[model samples]
Target: MTVLDVTVPFSTQIREASQAQHTEAENSTFMSDLLSGRLGVSAFRRYTEQLWFVYRALEGVTDTLAGDPVAAPFLRPELFRTSALERDLDHLHEGADWRSALRPLPATETYAARVLEVANGWPGGYVAHHYTRYLGDLSGGQVIRGIAEKTWGFAHKGDGVRFYVFDGIANPAAFKREYRALLDAVPVDGPERLRIVDECRRAFALNTALFADLAEATR
Candidate 1:
C-alpha cells in the first residue's frame, strides 16, 4: 500500500509563501527607528495617521463584504481599528483638528486604493490584506505599543497606543488559532489559493513601500 502525504494547510502555505515579504515589511528602516526610540512622537503620529487611511479603506467595506462568503468568515467586529485609531489621533493631536491636517503619503494613497480595489473586486484578496494587518497588530504590534507607551509616557494601553489594544479579544492566542482555522477553511481551490498568497505578498510590499516613504519623510 502506498502512503499519501496530507496536503499542507492553506494557512501554513500562505504564511510560508509570504514570509520574505513579511520580513521585509517588519524590518523597514522606519519601523526599526521607531521601535528603537530613535524616532520621536512626531514620527509615530505620522505613521498612525497613515494607518487611519488604510484601516478606513479596509473597514469601509464591512457592510459590502459582510454577506460575502469568502470575506464574511473574517469579518470580526472586534478586529476593527478605525475607532481606536481615531481616539489615538485625538490624544496625539491634543484635541486639535487632525482631520483638516490629515494627509496620506503617496504610498499610503496607493495602499488604501489597492485595499479598496480588492475589497470591491475579490473577497479572497480582501481577506489577504485583512490577515496581514490585523494579525500583525495582534502579534508584533504589541511590541510597538509598549515602546510607544514607555517612550512617550502615555498611559498603559491608553489613548495613544490604543490602536494596538484589542479590548474585545480576551485571549489573543486562542483567537489567532481560530483565525488561522478560518484561513484553512477558506473556500478557494489551488489556483485561487495561489492568488491569495500573491495578494498577501502584495499587501506586505505596499506596507514596505509606506515605511520607505516614511523613512524618507522623517529623515
Candidate 2:
C-alpha cells in the first residue's frame, strides 16, 4: 500500500488561492481607516459587537462536530474568542453589559449564517470557515489589537483589546505552524479541496462586505 504524501500543504494552497480576497479586505477603506488610526473607539465597538455574533455562530457548532476528523482538528479551544469579545465590549461600552449590544448588521448575520450552515453538516466546509476566521484572528488580528490599544490608550494593553489577545497560546508563530500542518494533513482532496478553497475566498469576500458596511455606517 502506498501511503499518500501531500507534498504541498493545503494551507498554502488556500492562502495563494484566496490572496486577492485577502488583499481586498486588508486594503479596504474600512480596514485602512481603522489601522491608520482614523476610526474612533465607537467604530471599534461596533466592530466588536458585530464580531460577537459571528464568533458565537462559529463556536456554537464546535461541540456537535467533535467526531469529525476534518472539522475536529480545527476546533481548537484556544481559538474561542466569545468571552474575550464580551470583555472588550464591556470595556468599550464602559461597564454596560454586552448583551444589549448584540446587534448584527445584515452582512454580519449573513456571514454568521453561512458559518452555521457548513458547521452543521459539511465537515470539510466547516474547516473552510474555521480556517478563515481563526487563522486570520491569530495573524492580522494582532495588528488591530495594537491599534485599539494605542488609539484608546488602553491601560496595560487592557480589557478594551482582549479579543486579540490569545493568552492560551504563548507563541503564535509556532502555533500557526502547527495549525498549517493540521491543514496539510486533513484527509480531503480533489474537488472537495477546491471547494474548500472557494469557500475560503467567499469567507474573505463576506469579510470585505462587512468592512464596507462598517465604513458606510460610520461615515
Candidate 3:
C-alpha cells in the first residue's frame, strides 16, 4: 500500500478520538457561560480575536506550502477554512468594534509563543500532522453547532457560530483524501517520519493543555 493509505487511517483515528472526547452539551454550557456570564464576553472576544491573528499569520505559511510541488498535491481544500474562520471571528461582535472589545491576556501571548516555537521546528509533513491532531479541537464544529443552536439561536441567528459551518461542508471524506495525499508526499526517512509523528502527538497535547488553561482562567 502507499503512504496515503497508511496516513489516512492515522488521521482518521485522531479525528475519531477527538469526536469521542468532545461533549457538545458541556461545551455549549461553557461557551454560553463565557459569552453571557460574569466571566466576561471580553475574555472570549479577546481570545477569539487572538485566534484570528494567529490564523492570519499562518495563512502565508499554509499558502506557501500549498503551492510547493511536494506539498500541493496533499493540501486539503478544507485548509482554506482557517482564513474563513478568522474572518468570521473578527466579525463576531458586529456593530460594536472588535478592537475596542479586545482585552489583552497574558495567556494569549503564552499560547501563541508556544505554538510559534513548535511551528518553527516543523518538518515537511508537519502541516498534515498539525491538521490531523488539532483541527477537531480548535474547530469544534459539532460542539459549536450545539452551542449556537441552543444558546445564541434566538439572539444572533446563525452569525454567532459562523466559525462552525465549514462553509456548509456536509462531507469530510474527500478532504481527508487530499490531506492524506499531502502527508504521503513528504520525503522523509524512517526516523524523521517517526519524529514528525511524535511531534504531531506533542502538538495535540499542547493544544489540550492550552484549552485546560483557558478553562481554568474562566473559573
Please tell me which predicted candidate would have the highest lDDT against the true structure.
Answer: 1
The predictions' CA RMSDs to the true structure, in order, are 3.2, 3.4, 5.7
Superposing every Cα of model 1 onto the true structure, what RMSD results? 3.2
What CA RMSD would candidate 2 show? Answer: 3.4
Instruction: List the candidates' TM-scores in order.
Output: 0.97, 0.94, 0.63
State the lDDT of candidate 3 residue by residue for 22-138, as single tens digits.
343224433546544445544454445655544544443555565565445544454544555545555566645665555434555554554455444553444534564335533
Question: What is the overall TM-score of model 1 with all chains considered together?
Answer: 0.97
Q: Model 1 misses residue 146 by how many Å?
A: 0.6
The true-versus-predicted C-alpha distance at residue 49 of model 1, in Å, is 0.4
Q: Which residue segments of model 1 deviate by more than 4 Å? A: 1-6
State model 1's lDDT: 0.94
Residue lDDT tens for model 1, 166-216: 999999999999999999999977778888889999999999999999999
TM-score of 2: 0.94
Best by TM-score: 1
Cα error, residue 101 of model 3, in Å, equals 5.6
> Which 10-residue span in candidate 2 carries the lowest summed lDDT?
1-10
